[model samples]
Target: MISEATQAVITHYERRHEFRGDVFGAQPYANYGYWARPDLTLEQASEALTDLVAASAGLGQGDKVLDVGCGYGAGAVKFVKRYDVDAVTGIDVTPVRIASGQDYIAEHSVADRITLQEGDATAMSFGDESFHKVVSVECAFHFDTREAFLKEAARVLVPGGTLALTDIIPRRGVDPSAYLTGETTNQSQVCLDMPANAYDADVYADLLRSTGFEAVRIESLLEWTRIPFADALARVAAASEGERAEQISRMATRIRQLIELGEDYVLVTARRS
Candidate 1:
């Protein structure tokens, strides 16, 4: 069973149009697209971010990949299309997302190379060393515990298999307690109240090491990610009106404020050693 917070995250993606327009184009993906540079459009940035994670995974022909928390299957499809992977197996706790992802694979004529199923991150059903690479994008924060998910990821990966992802991290030394009392906290609680497992960058690296991963690389992408994402949200909000627009505006504002306070969006990659 999914936790309440995880359910909320799933529901948010199911109605993603409320915050972001059709980001997946003809495909379906559930994430705030990655914005690597200041000039790229929202869609381009998101795809670029996907490419970044895929590159970090170091995929090659005939490689089997696992996409944990694989949203609507867009990222898996994108991975196979962009890389030479033999197949991508994606899992998410949300049954609706799994169904939608399955539909997307069939609709896109990639069923042979893509599979999506409803599965948990903390305790996956896959056998040990099942994949050559494991990747996720912006979804692990919803897991009951990142440590458990990391252990599961290691268990499913072949020796030296890579694990790559983008994640949200609270800034080092920033007191979350301040968020409880500040006026803006209400607007930013969406980020502030992220799961306790959403640790700072250093702590996240330590967790990966403790989980049997090595060559850990963690990079801060605050300037390129949050700012551009907020800009995209603001642009969308400016073009619309009413409660939905207000909600988007608030989200955009909150992202900007979070960045100002040292909160970060990070890209993390490691190899299962």
Candidate 2:
């Protein structure tokens, strides 16, 4: 039972998936990846970000993991192969992403270890205490109300299980409420869709605690993720031509604007209490 807001997000992704694929490549990741090194390629940086999130979640062999907003199942497949996780269940609202993820899983020969389904994150169907850990990479901000997804994560995670994700939040002194009222300028549609209450890290931590999580840790990855990603986009825009290049240039400009506006890209981790 996807809510209308969630459906709108699905539609947004479906419409932009092709353009995103062109920009991010065929590797099945849609994220502002952690650029660990200045020379890393986009795919490499994306994998690095996935590894960072997995490490933050303390993934272990035989762990059952759930990936919310798992785009194209790349993170799920990586978790299985890299950490030897017993199984990974990935859920995303966009049907096209699920279909592509199925193909990716089949190609990787990990069909038994990874499952991708079209489902709403804020209202998942999994039973309580269903997973050992939950991880989302760079997509949680798109959840209708990130707090709702946090509650769902708490419900599905085993007691003491971990949750880790990367998200975008407004820095102190910025009013996320303005986003709700359409007062913010130059914001991408996706940013505009983020619930106002999710804009601040302190509020985010409080929401997590209230939703049954503890020991929350939020680290800004602005330098590693957003800055590098914008740099890469600028390089791409310069090297490429035509509409794709124009799109890349626009995205680069948007990222720069976000940076100036004090938008923070953060990695947050917590445990179900």
Q: Which of the numbered candidates is closest to the native, going by highest lDDT?
A: 2
Deviation of model 2 at 66, angstroms:
0.2
Give each model's whole-structure lDDT: 0.78, 0.85
Candidate 1 regions off by >4 Å?
15-26, 179-195
The parts of candidate 2 lying over 4 Å away from their true place are 177-192
- Report the C-alpha displacement of residue 35, candidate 1, in angstroms: 2.8
lDDT (Cα, tens digit) per residue for candidate 1, span 1-273: 777656655665555533444633454654566665666766677778788889888977888999998877878888888796999999987676788789887887899999898888888999999999999998777677788899999999999999999887778887644442324222223322554664688899999999999999999877777778888878877977897678778878877876777577888999999
Tell me the RMSD of model 1 versus the true structure.
Answer: 3.0
Residues 116-175 of candidate 2: C-alpha lDDT, one tens digit per residue: 998888888999999999999887887877888899999999999999999988887786
Output the lDDT of residue 158, model 1.
94
TM-score of each: 0.89, 0.93
